[model samples]
Target: MGKKNVSGWSTIIMLLTAAALFTGCSASAGSKPSAELHEKTMHWDKMPEMTIDLDKSYTAKFTTSMGDFTVKLYAEDSPITVNNFVFLAKQGFYDGLTFHRIMETFMIQGGDPKGNGTGTPGYSIPDELDTELKYEPGIVAMANTGKPNSGGSQFFISTGKDSENLNQMPNYTIFGKVTEGMDTVLAIAKTPVKETKPIEPVIIEKVVIVQS
Candidate 1:
């Protein structure tokens, strides 16, 4: 839960510094992967317990109603997440998705099928916690509940200032942060919420990869 409007002055100095620190939490989508289509295409039981392949960087744009937000990933810093996100993104898994939950000052969490905040990509990644990064505002990280390695498809985008005590927790790998469209993020966060769910769903219509 958060209070008041969370405002962050986008200092050019801070932006440069932030670019040096963030890692890959991951993202997905290109084609419309229908629920029925995915069920037939992917086999949960046969899928490798750990199917993420690192050694790559992924850039994708989030096409939302508010605007488009782009994210860049770092596999070197968060290998497990990088692999996972790339795999899912290539599979077009995040299409037609909703940003299920959006809190005010606190981070907005998504990627759950339950919409109660307890869904995953059918597996979890080990924590790739590094001492360099903290839960700074605009910093993106995975959202986990129990244990250190229980993270999967869920993630959160920070709202206000840096988190005061999140760095103390072990695991919970941070994979990426917002590169542009912080205003859109703030607008999304400011959307009304009830019981942790947004009053008007912020749908990610599609994701497009932007090559360098």
Candidate 2:
């Protein structure tokens, strides 16, 4: 995928660089996040059914090499996006994935099974932007190909600094916000990168969905 800057850019996916072509190893520290790496070839022919109860609150606990963070999903505001995210989390689709694109001031993006920006879950979902969502720090949203209804498996978290710039590009669908571990999110944002890809891999060990 191609990449573009914040100014005069139409799509966030366009900011993808050649660094996405290579997968880096996690920095030396703790044990692997999972016992086995999740399969990458897993694909769906269509969007998942809405199985989650909208009356209940949903949160996703993300365990990564940098640390852990919890995102409260907006099921009522963005049901389709939340449903797909929860479905993938339950299916272990985000295990052993890397944050392929990390811009310190912009956002950190991952959930691409291919460890690159071009991979997807063999499906797509429509954009859900009718809420009072903003691209502020800790807000999580879906990344797309700058086309309507083009979002799939890739997602991003607003780190800080340049997050406000994202407001100008409102096509990405907002699904959740970080309720805990903002420090971890900020730390992950600072991971050394060559261009936009992390020089040392920041692995997303797993993503667990919790409901109440």
The TM-score values for the models, in the order shown, are: 0.72, 0.82
lDDT of 1 by residue, 130-168 (tens): 637667667777776545676666677778753423543
Please give the CA lDDT of all the candidate structures. 0.60, 0.79
Alpha carbon lDDT of residue 38, candidate 2? 34
Tell me the spans in candidate 2 whose CA falls farther than 4 Å from its real position. 1-39
Off by over 4 Å in 1: 1-43, 46-56, 210-212
lDDT of each residue in 95-169, candidate 2, tens digit only: 888898898877888987766566677778998987777788999988876667878888988887566655654
Candidate 1 collision pairs: 23-175, 23-176, 24-175, 25-175
Best by lDDT: 2
Please give the TM-score that candidate 1 achieves against the real structure.
Answer: 0.72
In candidate 2 the C-alpha lDDT for residue 45 amounts to 84
